[model samples]
Structure formats: C-alpha cells, structure tokens
Target: MTSAPLRWPDAADPVIRGDLTVAVAYVTPAGGAVVTSVSPLGLGERENGLVGFTTSLGFPKKLERILRNPDVALAYHTREHGFAASDSYVLAQGAASVDLRPSPERLAELMRASGPFLGEVKRGPLWDWLLREYHQERVFVDVELKRVAVWENLAARGAKAVTGAAWPHHPAEQEAPRNGTGPRVELAAVARQIHRLPHRLLAYRGADGLPVIVPVKVTSHDEAGLHLDLPAGLLPPGGRRAGFLAHGFQPQCVGLGMRTLTGWLTVTEKDAIYAPHTSKGLAAPPYRTLLTVSNGLLAKYGVWRAQRDGTSARLQALAARRPTD
Candidate 1:
C-alpha cells in the first residue's frame, strides 16, 4: 500500500470558480479511507456544474460483509485550473474499511467542529441555525488509513507522486451498545393540549377583516391521546380581540414552550416542537402540527356574504378573495 499527503486550501481558489468539494470514501475487506478534492463548482445555479466527476466505487454491502471480507481501497483525483499542465493534477488513494453504526453523539460533536469546512457548502450557511432550532441531526462514520498515495502536478502527462502505509485497525475497535434509555415525551398529546387551550384562536378571514375564532372539536383524543380538530367559524367582525384570542396565538400546554406562540402561527403550513435538550436530542418528542386552511371555503363564505348583502364591501372583498390574500 502507498501513502500520500492531503492538501486543503485555506480559501477557495479564485480561478477555480465554484464551491463544490468532492468527498469519496472506500471500504474493502481489509479497511477503509476517505479522499476529498476541493474545486470551485461555480456560484448559485451553476454550483452543480462540472469541476470533476466523483463516484463511490468500493462500498461494502453490509456490516457483516465488511467484517467478513475487510479489504478496501479508494482514491480521488483533480486537475489544475485552466487545464494548466497535466502535471498540475493531484491524486490520493488508500486502503479503507466501512464503519457501521457510528456514534450519534460523537457525530454531532464532529459536525460542530467541521462547521467551518461545511459552511463553505450550500447547506453550510443554514446548518448551524437549523441545528440550534432542533432541526438537524448528525450521524458519524470512522475510517482509519492503511496506506496513502499522492500524485501532484499530474497535470498534462508528467506528475510527482508520494506514498506511505500505516496499520489499519487497533484494539479500540470494540462496538458500543446503542444508547436507548432516555426521557420520552408524547408529542401528539402536547399538540392536542395546545389545541384545547380555551383562549387559543385560529385565524381566518371574516366579514369585517381577519377574524380569530375558537376551534371546534372534531374528534376526542384518540388512544394515542391526540385531539385532532379544525377551527370553527370565524368570529363576528369588528373590535380588537384580547388575551390569547388574538390571531396566531400559540398556547403553552406543556412546560417545554419556547417561542411557542410566534413559531406556531407563522408555521402556516407545518410546525413541529420537541422537548429541549432531551437525551435523544431532536428525534424524541417530535411534535408536528400541519395547518390546512381552505381558501376555497373562505372564498365561499365571502360569496355567501355577498349574496346575503352582509355589511361593508371591504368585508365582502376579503371573504371573496383567496385565503392566501
């Protein structure tokens, strides 16, 4: 086996023109290694454009297969900017193995550390924010190098090469049991409890303007204790509503409320809530609520009001318009 040095640029090369960085890992019967090549794939819509082709060639079918077989190898190659000299190209290859069932907690830590490298990618900008909002999860895979080979300035035809070999595995290869014991909170119950709050109101268009009305119980709590229902008729037009009766009100039925009201209302489509800092992290208590408003129904209500000559043209206009309006 051969060894090679991995070079990572501090900043994206201007001549390269894109932000894509290719990562390729190979797992074989003996071990596994990862090779990454960075080049500018371009900006915005052109990001996915060509820099170099990437493919995963030697992935093991399963953990059992990897353990039984164990031999693997992987390599990555890239050319210099402007097609300069063929010697300007680079290649790195090594023996590799597949690590199955990586630690979730450790993976999260690694992601936090790699924030800088990841931030350069498209999803990098939103990664931290999403993670903070309990929107992202992490999983980890570990690899040890058995050998490394590098070819630099392989640009046109001439290239320089370097190689090295190392041990693949160590005594630390013991598998740990999956983390299971943790506090589990019921999400549907929480949503139902939120829905049942007496002061909470659902927002909809009415005869006067935006009206906040209480929801009618469509069905009682099911075996899972979820009180699923829809909002009732709009409130009578006129006068500012008080208390939690305001449009877009989020009720705190559970102790784990964080930005409850504001987040829930704006969540006009789908919204979810999870227990803060649980052992299972974002996966547990995955409370989700999908708001389905009927623009057609609201329009029909306006049509009925117009046909009945209900007060004010503004009210009629609002009712007749689409729900999105």
Candidate 2:
C-alpha cells in the first residue's frame, strides 16, 4: 500500500529549510528509546511520503537497530528562550532503512553543514583527524512515514482544533487536513508545561535486551541528572545505558504537541551530580524553568510525607537552596 503524506504549513517549510537541528529516535536492540541530533539538511521529504536523512556508517548502534527493527520516530521543534514548547514540536512516526552508499562528498557536506550547530568546536589536530575519519565513513538513512502528529494552539485563537491520530497509526491512516497556522511555543513555555506535569514515560533497555517504558515521577532536578522516585519494579535488570526517553503530554491541549527529552538517564541513590561525560555541559543547573525542581513531581511521589499532607514546601525549599554544578 502507498504511504501517507506528511503535511505541514507551507510557510513553516522555510523554518526547516533554514539551518536547524533535528532529533531522531530509534529503538535499541534491548528496546530502549534513544534520541540524538542531526543536521536539518540531511532530512528531505520525498514525493512518495518518505523522509530521508544521512548518517555515519560509523554510527553503528543506530544503524544496527534500524536494520533489526524498522519502527522509528523523528521530531523537530523551535527553541524560543532556550526551551522547547509542546505546541512548537512536530513528531513523525515511521519505518526506516539504509539507502545509498557512503560517499566522501556527502561526508564533507555533512561535516561542513554540522559545524555551526556544534558547541565549542576546537580546530585542533584532533578535530581535523576526526573529520578525516568521518569522510571515510558515512551513509544514508531513509524514513517512510505512516503518520505525523503536530501541536498548534487553535482554540486559544477562537478556532476549532482537530484531534491528532493515535501514534503508530494503522496502514489505512486517516488524519485531519493540515492548516499550518499555529502560534509557535518557545522552549521555555514547554519547559514550564513539563515542570507542571511531571508524569513522564521513561524508556530504557531491559536485562533481556528488550526496550522497557515505565511511568516515573521526577523527584528533584540537579545538574547531575533527574532524581526519580520510581517503583523498584521498574528498574531494568541490566546496568544503565547512555540513552533514555522522557516524554509527557498535556490533555488540555489536545491538538498541541507532546514534549520529549532524549539523553543519558542516570539513576542515583542520593541526589548527586550529573555524570561528567554525559550532557557535554550544555546548560548548568539552577535553571529557572527547565532546570528548576518540580514541586508537582514531589507531590506526586509523596516526597517527605507530601502525598499524605499535599504539601511539598520542605522539598521545594531544599531544592531551591541546593547548589548546582
């Protein structure tokens, strides 16, 4: 059967054409959801409703997983005030496969186009050596979409909104026509929504090498990592992996998008510092919205007797006073 076409605002196409970074998520052999960034130029929409992108053959982890299981998701969003908004995000659920052989010219193009988005790039001998290696190894990944979900706040403007189709849609997918006229939500606004709604799905790999998604509550936020108070039953039998998926959605904004964070998830017995190698020092803690600890999370987990009393002042005060690295 033919695939469904991905629809977006024609005007918004320029935003994607402009220099922007996109996030791609794939399942690990063990079943955990891993998310990482790629250059927007690599993503192209085909006439047959397929979205294609290029990656490094050297990046074997993602490639092997895609070969084994074709299910995947691609996401893009605009950052306003350094936070991602629920309404500003777009998610594509599709199947993926490798296409085209690795070529030096394509590798060079990727290296050149990606340099601007990278943080603190060093032009030293090591950097040049890595570039040489990358040119030797790169390949293309093609994703064919079955469904697309987006968030735009139309009700806020006194218009009726369309409900998005359920994810992993059936082959005979049916969805609302694209209007493409939604206000952009900044990253800060999305961060606020996530903070207010701390109930998130945490994805990880299990001991059997299958993926596992569990419901977790945010305990505290620190530079170290997210402190989660989860049911002991949810811990994976295998040791931790470098990738995790944290996702949440707002019921009030049905047509608006969902929020997802893909990064290394580390669990700690006591609230501790985020691992040194992880995160690569993007933003430090003591964050106002994104980095700030969520009292709602504390209340949900009943931290310090909060569940019984419905008050988290003690934990809230402690989180506010704690020093961040």
Candidate 3:
C-alpha cells in the first residue's frame, strides 16, 4: 500500500515577489500528532492593483471541547526565503503556560533559553529596530499544539506573515514623610472653643476628621498673656496659620519699664505683670497705698478695667484714683 500525500484546500495562487516565507504548525490535545503548515506569507503589487493572500483554518466544536477538557496543542510557523523569512510560534490552551518574570536573573535565564528559538532575525539593524519600536530586550517563542490547527489552512496555502511584539512588567515605588512628628493640638477642644468665640473662628476638619482651632492671645508685653498649648490630636493639617496667630499677638502689650502714675508695675518675662502703686522714680509716702486701692477695686469689680472701652480710658481711670500724682 502507498502512503497518501497531505491534502490541502484548493485556493487561489498566492502572489509571492519578496524573499519572505511563512510557516505554521498545528497541535491537538486529543492525542493527535502535531500538524505542520508552511506558506509564503507575502503580498505583491500588480498592474491592476496590490495582491495579497492568507490561509487560515477553523477547528470543529468537538475538537475545541476536547481541548477545553485538559488537552493542549502547540503550533509554530516559519518561512525562509532568500535572506528574509517570518517566524511565529504559539502555545494553545493547556499546551503551555507563562509566569511573570521574577528577577533580572530569572528574566536573563528565560532569554538565554529562548535565544536560539528567537533566531538571528533579531540581530543587527533589525534587532535595533525591534528595540526602538517595541522597547523589548529579548523575544521568546511559545508553541501551541492544539490551537495550532486554526492556522493550518493558512500555512498549507502559503499566506503572508507579520511579527508581534510586547514589553515586560515593572514594579511601582513609594515615598516617606519629611518633618519629624511635632506637637499636635487637640481638635475637639479647639472646635468647642472656636464655636464659643463671638467672632467666627477659621476651622477645618483634617484628613483624620478632627477640627483645628485658631490660637488667641493678648499682644501687650506688660499684660498677662494666654498661651494655650493645644493637644496634638487637634493640630491643623498645615501648622502655618495656627503658628502665625499664636506668635503674631506677642508684640501689642506695653513693656514694664514705661512710667505711669499707678507706679512701676513688675512684668514677668512671660508678659504677666503685677500692678504698681507709684511711678518707678517716685517714692511713696505710703508704699502700699496704691496697691491696696487697686487690689480693692479689682476684688470688687473682677478686673473690670481690662475690659474697658479703651486702654487709655483704663489708664486715665487708674491715674485719677491714685492718691497723689
């Protein structure tokens, strides 16, 4: 008995004018041997117009179902004509699998193993062009036996071929915060105080969902100043505004050395001061006389002068009450 020649579909004669060749291979998972296909995947220009051809095949539903069950197929196609040819290989479902490139070493290993299969097509100017256009360092060939059948018809008829390209994956990076953890303010307390203030307090909720408060203080140097160290949790997102308000109020108060009929008051370094009875240069017939009077008034009125219409008015009132200027 004589062996039968491989049968292929009857198709139009493919126009091949270049040094390009095309080849294809098909594999089936159902214990079927790999079926090889070869073609001249190319196009040609004619007086009438440009002519080109492609040979492709479709598998039956039964074959597809069988492959889906766990069988795999491999397919490969290559064409060598003169100095140029097309090369391609595919791994059908279940035929082969690929994992993400691990380390540079792993990637290099894979490249080395695939180097021969990738062939000399990736050398010289062609390699440079591949690098420039596809941004790829190496190429790999995967064979799919089962799904390979689809292209059998194409290979048998000799169709024009083209190359495909892809790139590798990269990881992402993150950054750290700059300033060391400084003091933060208590947000809840600040919010409550802001709410109580007669004037609207500039308030905002931070990313953590806590309210930030504006600092308030007396500016006078000789006066007792209020410095509230807000709890850290309430600190504003950006400390600029809060820091400004806290420090900006420090210069308004008069210093302790200034002469006044009420006497030379002793101001603390922190800007707190005690009322005096006599001017710094003057000697009092009664040393404690003015102190006693001021203390008496403060006790009865609860420092009413601090809230007076004006600082000058408070000064005038104090001077008038003095025993003898």
Candidate 4:
C-alpha cells in the first residue's frame, strides 16, 4: 500500500518500544528460510539507519548466516507479557548489517535501551559473571527497511496500505502439488510439541525476496503434511518453501524453548500444508541462574568458534552522540 517508513503501529507504539520478542526469518545459504523468536529489546533506529535488534554470540549459527545474506524479515505478532496491547501484525523485510563485538560503552547503551522492557539490567560481579555471555559479548543487527506490511489482525487481512513491495494476490485456486512435497515430521509428535506452546508462526519468502510470516493454527495432520488453518488468507499459493516456528518464553528472558523447521508448503483456499525437511531447536532451563550459566558456556564456545572460523563481527556500536552511563 505505502512505501518507505512504516507507521502503522506507530514508532511510539508499545509494540515497537517494549515487546518481549519478535519472530525473525533469515535466508539460509541453500535458499530455504528459518524462523526463530528473538527479543528486539529496545527496537528502534540504530547506527545502520534502520530499526534493529541486539543478539549475543551465544547464537553463532544465526549470526553467521545473517552476515552471509543480509536479507531478513522481522514479524511483530505478539501482545503477550510486554508493554504493548495492540492487535496489529507488523512485518518488515530488508538488508541486515551486523555490529559484532561492540565496545563496552555500546553494549551498555543497548542494555539500557532494553531496560524498560526487560526491567533493570542485573549487574554486580555475581550477576555479570553468570550472565556475561548474554549481557557482555553481543552484536547489533540493523535492518535497512525496504518494505513493511501491516495487517489489522493476526490473520493478516485488510492491509492498511499496499505500499512498497507488491504482495501476491490470491490466485483463482490453490496450485497443484509440486514433486518432493510431503510430511516431514510425524503428525502425532508435532501436535504433541506444538500443543505445549500455543504461539505458532509460519514464514515463507515473499515474491520480493523478503520473508513473510503469518499466524497459523493447527487444524490436523496426516501423511501429507501438518495441516494448518490460515488466519485470514494465504498470500501466495502453496507448493513453495517455508519455515515454521512454535515457541514459549517467560518475562526477564529467564527461560524459553522453541521448535523451528524448514519445509515445503502446499496451500489451498481453505487451508495450507507444511512438509518439513529440517528441524532444530533448544529448550533452556526455566531457572534464571541455570539459563545464565548454560548460555555462558554456549557463549564461550560460540566466541571460540567464531574466532576459529574468523566469523566474528568486531564492529563498534556507532552511537557516538547517544549519551550513556
């Protein structure tokens, strides 16, 4: 509908200022997409001239992929335990630049930026030593917004304006199934896992080379694929590549778990089907100290791997004039 700067939820909207997390999709080297839930803590304009998110070295695979292909998508589809209370679903896709291994001053600012949404940062030697991987070794990924789409509801119906990139108009009917399209995971097992975490999202690359994520509900499953009830309407016909993510998290970033998959999709007028190909995820202990220590170990390993492979982004956070404590 519209182009350039997105203002549907409003820059000052609580969703932008203090959402616990958003689903991000990045392209894999193989051309498939993967989705995960991450905190864009204090998401707003950054050094890269676009809204951004900070991530820790604890997740090296994710960081490396972003460095390789800057194209990424961010979807704000939650109004849970956060400062926001809106029904809008915002998806922004653009090139991403990583500021890895930021200076202490920059890291502190990023932490302070997230203070309001996550509560005061836990410091002191005891807390810092335990949570160093999370609070210390970090990077910022700023997205150069190309296109942003906002829908009135999670179902993604009734676009506010059809600005920048042209979205796929629903064709006359669902396309015929493509070869190599079938169920990846056992329906019974998938249902068991998703049932634990109610929030479900599916992401597929849009026609413009960006990822489009939408809310989905599982209707049933069989040998073909995991059947999903589309929220509003399926933008593109099925028989395409997609990613699925189901997750659950608590406030303060204490504990979390998620299931992610890369799959083939088949869409019809009433529903869509996902045939997963690859799957990977993590489940952190719910306790703060435990989670912190676990991340500490992973970060230690990640930093080493990043160093060994020479994939670290040791860029300084260029918030030169942003005064910080």
Candidate 5:
C-alpha cells in the first residue's frame, strides 16, 4: 500500500551487514514465476545509485531469464530468536545486466564484498577450485533500483500490505464456488495427486509481520491439513498465521505442469499442519482450479524442455501412486 526509494550501502541495513543469501524471485521466459536463492559474492551501493551483487555463471535458467526479463525481487530474513525475527526485504522493479567476464579488479571487489560468506578464497581447495573451474566464467548481476517497495519490519506490518508486486501476494478473498468458478472438477483426484507430491515452501509471519518462508518435509496431507517435520527453531511458539505451498512439477513444451496448493499453516501436537486456503489444480471449482493447472502446465514447458526424457513421466507416476492418494 506504500512506496519508497531505497537507501543503499548503509551500515545499518542487515541485508548489507549480515552474511546471508537472499531469496530472489523472477519471471521465467514462459511467464511463470520462479523463486530461488543467490549468494552475493560482492555487494554494495554504486555511485550510480544501484545495488550490485556477483554470482557465478552457474544456473543458466536464471541467467537466461534475467537477460530476457530484468524485473526482479529480493528477500532478506533474520531471526533474533526461534520466535522473534523479522524480514527486512526490498523489491526492485527494474532491469538487470550480466557481465560474463568481469575485470580482475571488478571480481576482487565483488569477492571482497562477499567477505567471509564466500569463505577464504585466498588459498586452499576452494581457491584452487575457483581458479580452475569457475573464476574465469564468473559474472556480475547489477540491479538498477526503479520502483521499490521496502518493509523494514515486514512481520510486524503484515504480508498483506506488500501484496501488489511480482511477489505472489495472498489471495484477496475466498468466496463460495460459482457455477464453474472454483478448483477442479475432479477435486478428489487432484487432491490425491497433490498429496503425493513434496512440500515446496512453508510460510509464516515473522515477528515483525512479514512472511517467512521455510522449506519443509511433508509427512502427510489429509482432510485435516499437511503434516510436516521441520527444525524446531524454525517455527515460533503456538498457533500463528502462516501459509504453505506443496507442489509437483511436470515438464511440457511451453513451461511446466505444476500441481500446487497454497494454505494456512499452524503448529500442532505432533507436526506442523497446513490447511488449504486458495489453490490451483487440486481444489474443486467454482474456483477455476483447472485454469491454474493449465497455465502452470504451459508455463513449465520451458523448464521441462531442458530436462531429460521420461523425467516428467517419472514425476507424474510418482504423484499417481501415493499410498493414500
């Protein structure tokens, strides 16, 4: 609901001061959104008023997407204790460029910015590997700050406030299914498929009111919700407002076929549970789950094209034979 300009290179910004890899989100060539992590080898505010970071030439999927569509978002997270934490994240709605062969001086600057996070690359196997395998191909991704949405204490403010950008926001409202509006026609079938897949990401409001994402292992997903096993410290004490996305991916000609459910999460006696909220592919209509499934299938075509033959089939088969599904 609010906008601001980014003030970079400040000693106070935890993103700059702390040594952590931020989750980066970007749109795929096929228009699907993908979230991944990147460790900045070098970072700082530039004279031109932009924040820059260095990453290896690895991850061709990300590199290709960045070159085609420069719009991107970055999230930084910190925890004071198991329960007290906040997300101080920034969204940069702008363009990014890749410099495949950065000059020696530039590479040094990037490495220095990364510091201890990049480890002591001065010598040892790490340095030797960098020189022999990766150094020559390293690239710098410089993001120009344009339209920005920054939440200093995201958990305290609530995730809803920062909902308008490329970052997938919470669904507005869940009304009863219209004649043909909600979920899929074979809700049971879809649910079976979803229950067979793995947990993708877990969500929780950080102490400051921002959404916190934790990758989790789901033991089960039944009428009650998702049963998960995660690190004890990852969750706050007691029930809290949270979300989860459990998804399976299949490759197609355009992008990917994704079966996913987004839901509210809470801690229970034996496991963390995710109660289905708004979903695509797996829920029954009047919710239009079919369209979500269709779109995801199309979007993943690009990603699947890069996979080996039968990979999609194997994943589909895996989803089909779950003991409870």
Candidate 6:
C-alpha cells in the first residue's frame, strides 16, 4: 500500500503563500550546508505539504548538488512587501525532488499564479529573446516538509518545532570534518563586507539532519572570529561547521549584493563565535539594463561551463521523469 502525503500546519499558509523569497539551504557532498535565496513564485499549489521554487538550468551545479543530496531547508523569515501580515518566522525542512523540464503549459500556469506577487511579466520579442534563458530554461524543486519550526517573531529566537510525520531515531552526532577552522578571510575584512547588509543569516545542520537557518546579528569581532547574537534555545552548546550569508536585494533582484562564508562556530553560555573560513560574492550594477546584461553573460558562461563538466548531460537525464502532459 502507498503512504499518505505529508502535510504542514494550517497556520503556515501565510508564509507559504506570500513570502517573496526564502533562504534555501542544501547540504554539500563534504557535509557543509550552503544558503542561497530563491523566490517562491506561484509556490506550486500548497496542497499535500508541497512547496517549491524555480531555478535556471544554466546553473547546473545547483541542480547536481540538490540531486546529490535532496535534504534541504527553506526559511521564510521576511514579511515585508508580501501579502502575509504574520510577524512570525516559519522554517520548513524537507527532501527535494526536481522537475527537470516542465512543459510550456506548466510554465504559463506559474506565470499567471506569480502575477499577484511579482506583477505582470514583460512580453515582446526583445525581452522574450533576452530573457529566454531565464524564463524558458528553468526547472522546479519540490520540498515536502517533514518539520516546520515557528518563531513568535522574525528574530527566530524562542521558537518551537512541529513535525508532519513521526520523528526518526538517529544516533549521537559525529564531528563533521573541519575544513580549516576559519577567519581565513580576515575577521575585520569579512565584517566590513557584510555589516552594511540588513539580512544576516547563519545556516548549520541540525541534530535531526536538516539544515537549520536562523537570523543573526554581529555582536563584535576579534582577529579570530566574529561573535554573533542568535535567538534563544537554538544552536546547541559546542562547536560545529556553519555557513553565513548576508544579502540585500530590490524587487526583480536589481541592485543586489551578497556575501557568503564557510566557518566554524563554537557556542557557550557566554556567547557564540563564528570563524570565517573561505568567502566569495559579487555586487551587481543597480541598473536593470546592466543587471540583465550581466545575467545574460553569466548564463552563457554557466551553460558552457556546465556542458564542459558533463553537468548538462546529467541534468537532461533527470528530465526523463518530466511531465508528459
């Protein structure tokens, strides 16, 4: 007999329906969790505990990474400019299944569903050609949440967790391999880069095997690492590897700047310290035209790089399960 589909709490609908973007964290092959942002356009019918976001096929590394490890988390920590009036933060942890090549009909359905949140889609031959790679060449990832955590406020402190299915029993945690306890990028320098950005988030794998993302603030910094103030009752006492992401974006992803880091975090009654390991990011020109041009160039390069690395072939293979209709 088949099992029933998982379902999230009814209270989570606001976050599922209105949040502009979610901080999606996926685990890497080396057991590190990486955080990135994706808009939940249309959100794929929030029935049966399913929620999703679209990703470009041009960036095949992202697809391959998810395929390698479906375990993921989405944090709906922002309510500004969205239909939801809820002041709370909702986080969903689940496994992902990718739709490699959705049919055109499915894409149109998404466009219409997205209109309320993203406004109208631009048409005409010029935009159509320019943004074909972005609009046409896309895939979807569906995450069926196993656990949903809610915080009374956006701070993500003083939170509670609700599970959709029976919780599993896992063994005592093993220390993840240290990839150079960081501050490798210079604590002061890294702080300078992300300090101005309003959104500060840290991602670490939870004991239940899901990557937990929490909003954080920089308390202070030393030559060794950056100290952070996180929500209460989160982050177990001890040391572990974590990822930090600071970003700012306007509507349509214009005028955006993001910085990410991998590091080691040690938590104690006194405080939690984050040591930055490696870092990379970019600042896009604020102008829409310039950003579009930049995206076109990057998409082109991404396709070539993906093809060269055989990621394109692997992605196509995943398309075999695409919808027939």
- Who wins the TM-score comparison? 6
Error of 4 at 131 (Å): 3.1
Q: Model 3: per-residue lDDT, tens digit, 252-288?
A: 1111011111111112233322222221121112223
Candidate 2, superposed: residue stretches over 4 Å from native: 4-12, 80-87, 103-130, 153-325
Better of 3 and 6 by lDDT: 6
Higher-TM-score candidate of 3 and 5: 5
Q: How accurate is candidate 4 locally (lDDT)?
A: 0.72
Q: What are the RMSD figures for all models against the true structure?
A: 28.8, 19.4, 42.2, 5.7, 15.4, 3.3
Candidate 2: global Cα-lDDT?
0.43
Candidates ranked, most accurate by lDDT first? 6, 4, 5, 2, 1, 3
Model 5 deviation from the true structure expressed as Cα RMSD, one decimal place: 15.4
lDDT for each candidate structure: 0.26, 0.43, 0.24, 0.72, 0.46, 0.76
lDDT per residue as tens, model 4, 1-325? 9344543335325556657788999987655678999888757763233767887765777876776677898888877777777777777778787876478998878777777666666668877776676677787888887766777675666654443456655433223335466765666777787778768899876655677788888887778778887765644664777789999888766668788988788786776788877677778888876776787778777777767765553322222212241
Expressed as tens digits, the lDDT of each residue in 1-325 for candidate 6 is 9555666666678877888767888886666678877778638455577888988766576787787668899988887567788877888888888887789997877778777765566677876776667666668898877777777788976636565644334223337465556467777788899887778888877767778888999988997699899987676677777888888777656677788888778888899898888887868788877777676666666666777988778877755534331
The clash tally of candidate 2 reads 11
Model 5 ranges with Cα > 4 A deviation: 1-12, 79-87, 122-130, 152-156, 159-325
Sort order, TM-score high to low: 6, 4, 5, 2, 1, 3
Against the hidden true structure, what lDDT does model 3 obtain? 0.24
Candidate 5 lDDT score at position 212: 46
Q: Candidate 6, TM-score vs. the true structure?
A: 0.89
Which one wins by TM-score: 2 or 3? 2
Instruction: Give me the candidate number with maximum lDDT.
Output: 6
Candidate 6 weakest ten by summed lDDT = 165-174
Clash count per candidate: 35, 11, 40, 5, 27, 1
Summing lDDT over every window of 10 consecutive residues in candidate 1, give the lowest-scoring window.
276-285
